[model samples]
Structure formats: structure tokens, C-alpha cells
Target: MTLSFSPSRPAYLGVVRVSAWYDLVVTAGFATPWSYALLHGGLSSVGDALGLGVLPALDPIQTLYANLMGSVVVVWALLRLVRPLAVHGLFDGAARSLFAMWQAYALAHGAMKLLWVFLAVEVGFGLAQLLPWWPSRSNEVEPALQGR
Candidate 1:
């Protein structure tokens, strides 16, 4: 007798893809407001000391362009997940590799940190495929596998 694992549900994949897309959209939306607050609301003091002052000084147009480009990349990732066949192997593989790296970063860096919570959620989205279909007890053996 042998136990078997089933393929993941389509709904799970859909949820993961949608969640990733939503995260990208929300982050893009916040970029402008956050950048504005950082530039004009006293954040420059700390940024200047940290040698990161140049970022906040970016004009709104420049910021929007950067954010839009980032959003496009994220959307591309989501589309790959939703329809893997539509993307070429090299591009899909690269996106998946990057997604894995981002997940590792989120986990190793401590997700509880304010800036990392979104990363944590992104990790969850990527890992949705690993969720178990049903709870199991360590000592339990199913009838199908009992003889093996």
C-alpha cells in the first residue's frame, strides 16, 4: 500500500494570484503618499543623516514612474501564476526565483517589523501551494497505507 498526494486546487492558485496582485496595487497606491510625507513632513531629518535623503527628494513624476514600473513587474508575476503557459520558461523561472528570494528575506528579517509585514503576506501568497488539504495526527495511518 502507498499514500499519495493530490495536486493543489485551482481555487488555491487563484487566491494566491489575486492576493499578490492586490498587494502590488496597494503598495503602488501608497508610494505617492508615503513619499510625500517623507519629503515634506520632517522625515528628511532622519533620511539626511542616514544618507538616504536623495530618495525622498524625487519629483512626483519620477516617483510615479518608478512605482508604475514596479507595479508592472508585480502584475506580470501575478499573470504568470494565473496562466503559467502564457509566459516563457525563462521569464517565469526568473520571477519564481525572485519570489522565493523575497519570501526568504521576509522570514529571516522578522515579519513583525512594520516594513516587513507586507513581505510576510507576499510570502504567504507564494507559499499557498504548500497548505495541507486536511489535518493529520502524527501517529495516524490510513487504511490505504496500513500494509506498506
Candidate 2:
């Protein structure tokens, strides 16, 4: 019997990349509708109900722009993950940068809960890249040493 070990760094990265892409796609699809609804429906009613002194009207163009910006940021973050650079240096740096930007955006928008969720996802992805998974060794019989 023999034991062999294999590392799965590439596969881990591939899964991360796929997850990132899926996020981007879903967000992109949701962005337009959400922004439109926020601008047209919620903002005014919420502002009036809260007596926020005539909140600024939502601009569809601005909403679209913000959505595009978010998509771009997310894509950049994904790229950082997929880049074939040193795990510790380039990948980590890029991930941190992107996550910081996301946090800032969320804070600016008063979306703390969303920000936390995004932060968690970002941290999880970074940790996945940082952690190494060593393959399990197979059980094998070994001979005992004899002493005179």
C-alpha cells in the first residue's frame, strides 16, 4: 500500500471565480429593476413618511450609473481573485481594495446590512484563497523494526 497527496489550489480558485461571475450576473440583472423601483416608488414615499424635508427626486440615469459602477467594481474584484499573481501579495491586495470600496459604497447608501453581507462574502473568498488544502493520505501497512 502507498499514500499520495495532491493539492487543489486551482480548483478552489476556479470555484471562487465561478461564484464571483454568478454574483455579477445576478446583480446586473437585478440592478435596473431595483434602481427603478427605488427611485420611482420607495424613495419619495419613505422620505415623505419620515418627513425628511423633501428628499431629492430619484434620477433614473443616476441610478443606472450607480448600478454600472457597482458592476464594474464587482468585476474588478473578481479579476483580482482570478489573476495569476502571488496569493499573498497581489491577490490579497486586490481583494482588500475591492472590499474596501464596496464597504464605502454600502455605507454611503445607508445599506449597512448589505455591506456586512458583502464583507462576509469578500472575506470568505479571500480566506478560501489563502487556506491550503492538503490531500488526505491513504492507510498503509508498515513493517516494524527488529532490535537484537
lDDT agreement with native, every candidate? 0.45, 0.48
Give one digit per residue, the lDDT tens place, for model 1 in 6-69: 1132344355456556645644443454644443434446545655442345466756764665
User: What shift in Å separates residue 44 of candidate 2 from its native position after superposition?
Assistant: 13
How many angstroms is residue 77 displaced in model 1 relative to the true structure, after the best TM-score fit?
Answer: 6.6
Clashes of each: 0, 0
TM-score: which candidate is best? 2
Model 1, position 84, has a per-residue lDDT of 41
Candidates' RMSD to native: 10.4, 12.0
Tens digits of per-residue lDDT, candidate 2, 23-126, equal: 56535533564754554455456545665433345566767766776666466546645662223322443565576677768657764233455566666655
Per-candidate TM-scores read: 0.39, 0.42
